[model samples]
Target: MPDNATRVLILGHGAMGRAFETLLSARHDVAVWDRDLVTGVETQPLEAAARGREVVMFALPSNPHDELAARLAPCLATNALCVSIAKGLDARGRTPAQVFAQHFGPRRDWAFLYGPMLARELQAGRPGFAMAASLRPSAGARLQALFAGTALHLDCLDDVHGAAWAAILKNVYVPLIGAADGLALGDNLRGFLVAEATRELAGIVEAMGGRADTAYTLAGLGDLVTTATSASSHHRRLGADLATGDATQLAASGANIRSEGVHTVAMVRAHALFAWERFALFALVCDFLDDPARLQAGLDAYLARRFAAPTGR
Candidate 1:
């Protein structure tokens, strides 16, 4: 390995993991491990792969973070930095960053990498942008060095919580965009949904103790545009399915859709994480998801309330 090249272990062999491998293998000593074995891929045991690594990237879903972090806590180098690319809350409604904080605390440095990084584009050697947010400045610096001169560009920020929340929250609106498209509501409504979602996202971020402006950054608006507009985006497709009343069609097609936004919608509603009543757009999406039959009526009601004429006192 080159002197500047870092030893990086990527947990999970999913699309994002492969994308990261494509972005870094030529420049760094990269090793990948997944819970399930993949045919013809060289991989060592978890402990062996993690040992002596300078950085460990948790490219898995947020749900498995707690278990993985605990298992790897003793195997990592003392100064290794852990980064998560997950954009959803875990089963307990805890972000991956929060799970890392619980397991690693101040002893092990951790960070979140989030933005408009679609796995397919990155795997195709296209450029991707993300914010590397960590409470510790050194963690972000190390992450930047690891991906230097690669297709993945990293901008460092100190607002780890803000970036994490922004990334997760943006997915919540993707289905709404897709629903509009599915309903054949035209580009005008699509644009309106994006703007309204961003406004609600900013407020939710602030309510959750993150910077409101973070909602407009790469982690928020940038990702929202990418996921909401991309034809292959699962959450967007879920919205379209709901709008068309064919929510089961995607599953029948064997697309392996994770649809993180679906889980987020349930988590947010069950936990009352935000003032749902104040977010008409989000509430509308949730109502559609909860009962697809109401989609048309809900959309009509939402627009009616949004555009109602003001009555003079």
Candidate 2:
């Protein structure tokens, strides 16, 4: 509508996609696409949505990324910026960036949006910050500039791999805090979970050829805190349900709900991208997830070995 407005094509009709449309439509020419006929916003055919848009924002989960990316590759305007909000690994253990790169190649500019952003809070106009990671040094700053007047404050990151991995791994770790909460382990253990999870995340990130320190940034630590502590967080609630060992309770939480962390645990275990055993805290969570009966014994063994390992030997 406005002369300076950038054309934005949003994929998916989910909450995150709708939120982005709600926030940016008034200012920018926005079009949304979904497989089904969606309400609340006008839906466009895939080709029409991708045509001439300056930026294509994917609001779907990671599972659909590769397919949708392949479909949209030929439709996208040359050099259009592609943004991913998915925070988990695909079936091939590929990050969103990797999926898009495989499909879009050098035809599109790529960026990942990650941090403590909940679509509901964002739609309600709550102030929030996120990291925009890109391999191109100017991509982050350019993205930051795009939201210059918005409530969403964005910081750019050059370590795209580090930021992406940090964001992904935080989801895997957040549920541990929730399980601790379900067990009523108190703030003391909560503090330990935070410290140990961050440390383990850094090690995994480094092993995967990413900057280990990125784990301390907003994409990693900031998001971990939000997902771990928030009562509204599905992953947190899932953890609490897991701790109770009630299959019906877990089932009642809904099969359709996207718990990125659940899939991430399996991916980490299957991929062997890192020395997963070295990160005892992460391994503890994985072992517990794989066999809930091991929650108590696994935790005890982890703590015992951690404390008893002789220092300065």
Candidate 3:
């Protein structure tokens, strides 16, 4: 982080990528690279951006991380660190860091970055903190300080695995709760929903080897609150629309930002990886999205559970 001359190639010029380029530009040599980089970013090609860059941060859509990792693996500088900003799970049920490690290949160090960093806020130069981690400490720090600017605070963790796992576990819970808001539940019920769902998040994170304390930190719980409640989130809006019925029309109306929790919920069910205690309802939530009667049944169960075991499912 102490160095200023490092060239940084930010992959995927989406909202988060642009925000990062703007935030880190003054502190380092920064440029964006996406599939549509030349057009979407109004810039040069990614291969061109990689020239002399010491670090490459992968901010692509969650689904294509592995593809990009494999594509960019050969071109990356031997010493460059490939950082991941994606918070969703991959096809192999791996976190972004795992995908990079397996697919990013020989040249660069693979790492992950995670937090409650809202792209809109970061684009505005709002003060925000994020974490960077990799199995290799020194290699991880190459891009760590690139984001350690005054407006963008940074923390260094050695465990990218735990950090990424916690991030997605929390992200996986946000939208379902947002759908509850559309269910027209009163504040009391919403409060219980958040508390229980987050407890589920914390449990899953710990089960996956993250600190239980991490869930209370800005990266996990804070991210859940923001993604679940913010009017700006496509995920929340998607849930609101789903609750109102007519999901196909809602998708057509919404912005291009993918509904991360929607995809995550499907994958979550396929993996059956988490403790269903407080989160068993989410299993129903997945199916209920397609059936109105089942959706109503979920609400009824929420009420039933509310009085039965406040401790958890």
Clashes of each: 0, 0, 1
**CA shift at 14, candidate 2, in angstroms?**
1.4
The total of clashing pairs for model 3 equals 1
- For model 1, residues 1-313, the per-residue Cα lDDT tens digits are 6877888899988899999999899989998887753363445677878889988998888877888898888878789999999988877888888888888888778999999889999988889999998999999888888888888898888888888988988887898889889889899988888998898899888888989998988899889999999999888888888778786854553312367777787788778877877778888878877787787798889889889999899
Question: Each candidate's lDDT (Cα)?
Answer: 0.85, 0.81, 0.68
Candidate 3 lDDT over 33-88, as tens digits, reads: 76653355425655666767788877775667777777666777677777877877
Model 3 accuracy (lDDT, Cα): 0.68
Q: Which candidate is the best by TM-score?
A: 1
Which model, 1 or 3, shows the larger lDDT? 1
Off by over 4 Å in 3: 1-3, 37-48, 104-108, 249-257, 271-278, 309-313
**Which clashing pairs does model 2 show?**
none
Error of 1 at 186 (Å): 0.8
What would the per-residue lDDT of candidate 2 be over residues 273-308, giving only the tens digit for each residue?
Answer: 677787888888888777776777887887798789
Q: Which candidate is the best by lDDT?
A: 1
Candidate 1 lands at a TM-score of: 0.93
lDDT of 3 at 242: 76
Clashing pairs in 3: 1-145
Choose 2 or 3, whichever is better by lDDT: 2
